[model samples]
Target: MLDKTKRDWWRSVVVYQIYPKSFQDTTGSGTGDLRGIIQRLDYLAQLGIDLIWLSPVFASPQVDNGYDISDYRAIDPMFGSMEDMRELIAQGKKRGIGIMMDLVLNHSSDQHPWFLQASSSRDNPYHDYYVWRDGMPDSPPNDMQAAFGGSAWTWVPQVGQYYFHQFVPQQPDLNWENPALRREIYDMILWWMEQGVEGFRLDVIDQIAKEPDRYITSNGPRLHEFLRELSRETFQKGCLVTVGEAWGADLQRAKQYSAPDGSELSMVFQFEQMMLDQQPGKEKWDLVPLPFVKMKASFARWQQGLHGCGWNSLFLDNHDLPRIVSRWGDDGAYRVQSAKLLATMLHGMQGTPYIYQGEELGMTNVRLPIQDYQDVEIQNFYQKRLGDGYPQEEIMNSIYAKGRDNARTPMQWDDSPNAGFTVGTPWLKVNPNYTAINAQSQLADPDSVFHYYRKLIALRKQYPVFVEGDFALLEAEHPRLFVYRRAWQGEELLVVCNFGGEATPWQLTQEWEDAQVLLSNYPQHPGDLRPWEAKIFYRKNGAAGES
Candidate 1:
């Protein structure tokens, strides 16, 4: 549980992450643009979001979907111009919403001026801006593997050296070891801050402070020093919300990155909870059922361990993940019920909640064949598996369950053609279920997933207990039930969710029998919970038979 006496505006904020390229397209370019996002400000405001975390639309070759930055100062032509971006900021502010940009500090595009000059000659001024090592043409300097699976080092023929890249070859890892490079990045951060941008979502920030010799990922020895330096240079200016995408961070590292001392960042997104269903010693493409005890223990530890020390980023789906309803809930026969249940579990937790675009409508993953997939990581994976003689169906099946493209599908705004996302053809296929699942269909239905999410967000804003309350986990071993309680001052909230596909007994103690319902997915429930049902109950101290 969090300390109710200590309050921060961001703790009660609801963030919505929008992938610009898939959000909407107003120019008939078959890709979403800034103008498209601006047109939807009211739509997002209606959903009760306080902040918008837009994915990168910076100048790039689109190798990793704008992540490989060619220029930090300009918007990609495909996404409209700088004027459009500024207009978005001004308009969002009018609605009481702030904007968070995706800041990719770990690397720059190989086509970037810095990388191009660095690759030109060993004595070039920008040569030290990126990581490079002397090695034989055919051999890498080390045995480190790239994130998408391969040697981390790529040969640069003109420079007669190998440069390190944690992702694809087009994305070259920057050398934070150099004082000049770090300053350049810091200056860029300040430049955006000066543009009325509220904050940044630091991309792969944990990998930025890698060991100079080993290329290891996650919390390096110099991580604290670097983060503190960033805070001193950028975050100290105001109440901007800076979050890091920390992939392999541990509990201790999580505490350090966003501690109350304000030396590092506002918070960080850790992948442990997202990786619960992944098999050990296997790649992310491999999937398994989530272990109840393991997940329960993890949730409890993080909640208690970081109680007053740091903050957590509460989420279930993002642009890089499969839809939550499809992955963690019953999406076949009970999609709506399960989606609402997942939302209840997410918003009831003690942390700032993040809603990925289209998640509010209970979007499910699209089962696309290999040919229909449109993601760089998925393309590379499928190519490798095909070359390795893996069956096509086996590869497609794995992709169907864990593909990043699942979350990248065009937004389903209405039942019209193309889901009303774009007047032109969409870059990727829209989910075929949009006809029945789009926002237009749900907006009119009071019991739709959209309304449920709206209610959850409104509750967080209205109740202090949902924001700064203490959390207590129950039924740690209950395979079907996710039971937890949040207490603040004299108010206690009991949140019970059924993650299974069948009815389960509600083991209420005597004190909890008279609990009044605050919210419920279904109209009513007697002694048992229906499949994927969720409910929250309110009780005050000494109010009833005391559970």
Candidate 2:
């Protein structure tokens, strides 16, 4: 059993993200529900994961796939009742696994009662529950564009005003400036914690601190104060872990939020690494090559800046991202090899590692035709492409390269029909590669990517260096390879990943004389890397003790 008394349980833990809608459907309703997750507790425990972060199960309109919550206190009807959630938590705890629920506090569906009341009239008690502004004559407030690609202001005919929506118009941003609204959110959070949840994964957490006037900028004077208040009241309870999704967070801001003094969150997810593929002049999802040098430099910067000052929630693929095997590595022909390489690189990093559902099984992104795209974000971009006078071929190419729905498909559990996710039709089409990339196929093969992840998690738990270690970027100038070192106490770990699709020669530095091959994506020592292969080496003496 994993030790629960560790000072930083998150550092050594491997969190598996589960998009409840796509995980499994026990009721044959073509949608995964909480009872389905309850049935899979043993499977998750067998996978050796420390925690499971379930994407929002709260009441939502399914507009943003549960990210736009309507009722924070009740479970969505489509995802089973609150009793099912309680049972899932109870069963998960018995398997030595914790549960983290997604907390979408930044915004709520327009269907939410609070939003309905806020938009009902100008003098309603909940009128200030959400951001509402009067249009100055005929122009909207500022030039802040909605992230979903339109005007951030949506005119509410009922209120004769416009409300702010960072995402879809159906979802309205909550007014965090309202003290009563803040208390209500906190009360809901505490209520869930009392119901046996171990932690929360705050969605779009950085968006909550939007400047009252500036709106888009961070570092608002009141933002830190609000976070500090939340930390003191909601997060300092010791058992409840809080991880924030803070996009565009720099190292200094990360430190202030995750300081050991417990000012804000326990850790925050940084999006700098994820934004590498975004080209200079592109608005749509454009696929650019993942430059190893830039990736190395970004990792080094965060490592140097946040060492002992803050914590990072390290991840590659999530419901919002394209599969790492497809985007970062060569997933076409070198799928298995590249998957293992990406796993080694992410798991060996000094942070709390998150493994998306089916990531351990080397699940590649689903290839969807332009007509099959269902994600609102993708649809918005496609409409933008049309409105901007872009050719249909260019829009199709962009969708093929970077659609969020590629990662939102049903989890591949086995070679059976519907990827063993449901006996009924899946909500989204399953990837055809599920026949070869299922968990059952990988579980039987000891050398599969799934087993590599198992080893990586085991190593993180076994060696303190993998968790609380200080990180040092090795000065290897090879463009095809990314290398780094982690040292803590007297142990050291050397991580080398070949980002290219060709065999590359890796020269071990003299300082790694005592290194032992701990793990590798390909068979180490005897076998050479076949493009995007990775290896982890453990040295007897730490980097500090060497030389």
Candidate 3:
């Protein structure tokens, strides 16, 4: 067993994300709840996860699912009661898994008490809790667009003013400039921590400290100052682990946020790798080539930048992203090979690894018709394309290829009805491929993707080189392979992955000749790496003759 004392708990930890609505439905109400999660603790424990980052469970109107929080202190009834959440924390503790709730501090549902009160009258006490402004006569505030599409500003008839919502109109951005509002949010956070919750996964954290300019900029003076105050007063005590959902943060800014100084956050989920498919100067939903060189360069920059300065929350797929096996790997045929390869490439790097709910089973993206799309972002894009005179086939093709809803379908738990997620109807339709790709089938197969994940996670715990070692990318002149080295103390680990579909050959460097094979996706050594084969090697200190 690894020495728990020697490791920074967070550094060696693997977090599993639970999209609450689809995890399990205890009440048979066609929705997964907190009670369902509590009941499923043993299943998660068996998966070797150290932390559970539950997506937003706070009270919401479900406009953007649960990202729009109506009340920071209350659990949504669709999920469960506050008491149910407390019980979940209690049960999760017995299983040795920490729980992190999603903190949507950047905005709140317009139905929230604060927003409701703020909008009721101009003189309401909570008027300043949200950003309210007088319209500039005919022109609106710049050309700033809402992240979910359309204008960022919405007219509030009751207050006779316009309010800013960076996302949907129903989710109004909170005014962090208001000191009282900030205190209220922090107090809520403290209350949850006191109730046995471990920490928070801050949603759209970078947007919390936006400038009046209403554009994408990082580390604004006010933003840094507020974060410093938040850390000094709240997170610096070390009982809580905070990670930020910062989309555009570069390496320098990530270092500042995650530095040991305890200023902002423990780590931030940077989106550079996730944005690999996006084209320059075009809207984000557009599909482009997934260039291996660009992907390698992005990962290398982040790995080198945070070498010793700070840390990153390493992940490939999350609720907001398309399935990794489908987007980054060849489809179901080479799924197992690519899944293991991606795991080797990511888990061997230095950072905290987060596995999305269905990633271990090698789930592919759902193929849905245009009418099946429910995500606000996808809907907005479809509308925009139609308005712009784009052909219906082009619009449908984009949605099919890159829709956010592709990742939100119900979990595939079995080959039974509704993939065993629920006995009755599911909130969203289950993927039709669930019969062949369910977890029950994979769990019984030793060579399945699920087993590979178990091995990958176990290796991280078994070897310190994977969690705390210095990472160095090997110069493999081949375009189809990704190679890197992790070294610490007297231990060294080499990871090589074939990112292509056909067989590829690689020449071992002089430094790699002394290494012995430790693990591999293939059945034999140096055989043809049939599309996405991964191999790990442990280096011997000296020549065998000397020993």
Candidate 4:
């Protein structure tokens, strides 16, 4: 069954996620702000996106690039004033785009008033706002490790207890077991909804309910109850979109998290495929070549497992990961083709496609020295690896390959001194190749990656097949080619992506030989698929969508 509202509101929509701090800086404060986003609404509209997902512009202490939210209702001064936020909402509506705020309900910055009061004394009413334990005063409460690194528990001598934080020491994990705390969070969410924000991307929402008496975290027994309650309270009230950042969610868990009854979220992001390149038992900075067969298998499982049951979110990179071109595609010789190939593969599937900022311009990863890096996790990784006796060059290379900062660099708007992101000094170094690879250069070129992406987005809007199609993997064993077919109402799209930098023979079966090309990175139909090539063919009843 579809959602009860039957809105079909988010199915074919495309979302462009903007890490506000690095998107554009107009305040001369060396940081992107609400005003910057307001100024670029036209630019975003030109991309043909239906929604803009801003990555946490709320008041923060910059401990984790705004993810460590200090205030739920106030806009950060560094980003803009509350008036600027209201203006952004009004202006964005005028441009025919909806705004989705990133809601970090999983944790709050330790500097937040509640946390401060909670940490002050045992008699404080807010003491239970966060998870606090008084066990083994000299030792941690548990053996759990923080997602960033080190012990998850921190000693708070002021309260004579240790507080649990799933991330850094400064971000205390909220205790959802407390009904009063839950009420406060829900109230904050309603306040944002009242301000005209249409949707929210729930940050680490699955981890909001931690299991009892366990060192591990997330997916506690009452997880579904909490999500269902939150949904009934906030999203179900209106046709608002909500997606959860579920780190280890599988197909079954995802189905429950985003049930067809609409009791929970619209969809949940699974990190299994994202972690396919990670070396097990090592830090995130540890990199390994992506296993192709595994990647194909994981994607196919999600596509098949969620079909007719739940929903899927299609994406390659986001603010917390390395650029897609550098990781899965060739960032050097075949950068443009590979970028287009990845886009074609993602958008042709049966899911809501997400385009991260600068991705439309085929932005590759930044190679910054250790001294130039700004991400706290990256710096922490470097120091940890160095203390563990790893070589400096190897650690630096690892950081270059997998550091989150690679995707956090300022967007390359033009070939200006600071890539046109800012008139003053940039908070982070712009990618050096921005001169050759930037939005301005691509926008002027007809055969640019940006144009190809625009075409893909338009096609999805034009055809319901892209939104409500049944998916099937064409060649499960094809090593270099990722082939998938989506069919709906006698309309089908055959998407073939050559993932490697080598030419290979690719021909359709006799039954599908009459397919006509709907999209392709290359100009001509190559009997042998070129390196890093992608082609999307549309087959109608007895003819093709295009000749």
Per-model TM-score, in order, reads 0.96, 0.96, 0.95, 0.97
**Regions of model 2 farther than 4 Å from truth:** 3-7, 136-138, 215-219, 526-530, 542-547
Give one digit per residue, the lDDT tens place, for model 1 in 1-547.
2221232557778999999999989988779999999999998988999899999999999999999999999999999999999999999988988899998999999999999899999999899999889999998788988888788889999989999899999999998889899888888888998998877899999988776466566677787898899889887776678889998788899998888777898889988888989889888887788887788788888887788789988999999999999998878889999999999998998888899999999999998767888898999899989999999988898899999999999999999999999888899999999998898889899999999999999888777788877889999888778899998877789999988888888867787888888899999846788888899988788634332
Q: Mind giving the per-residue lDDT tens digits that candidate 3 earns over 75-96?
A: 9999989999988988888888
lDDT (C-alpha, whole model) for all candidates: 0.88, 0.83, 0.83, 0.88
Predicted candidate 4 versus true structure: per-residue lDDT over 1-547, tens digit per residue: 1142444588768999999999999978788888889888988888898888999988889899998988999999988899998998899888778889999998999999999999999889999999988876668767888878898889988888989998999999999999999999889989888998878899998888885357548888788899999998888877887889999697899999777778899998888888988798766667888988889889889988888889999999899989999999999999999999999999998888899999999998988878898898988888988999999999988888888988989999999888999998889889999999998889899899999999999999887789888888877887898998888877888999999989989888776788888899999854899999899888787544432
For lDDT, the strongest prediction is: 1
Q: Candidate 2, which ten residues in sequence have the lowest lDDT sum?
A: 211-220
Task: Give the range of the ten consecutive residues with the poorest summed lDDT in model 1.
Answer: 1-10
Q: 42, model 4: CA deviation in Å?
A: 0.9
Going through the candidates in the order shown, the clash numbers are: 5, 0, 0, 0
In model 4, what lDDT does residue 445 have?
A: 93
Give a tens-digit lDDT track for model 2, residues 372-413. Answer: 777999888988879989888888777666788888888888
Q: What C-alpha lDDT, on a 0 to 100 scale, does residue 342 get in candidate 4?
A: 93
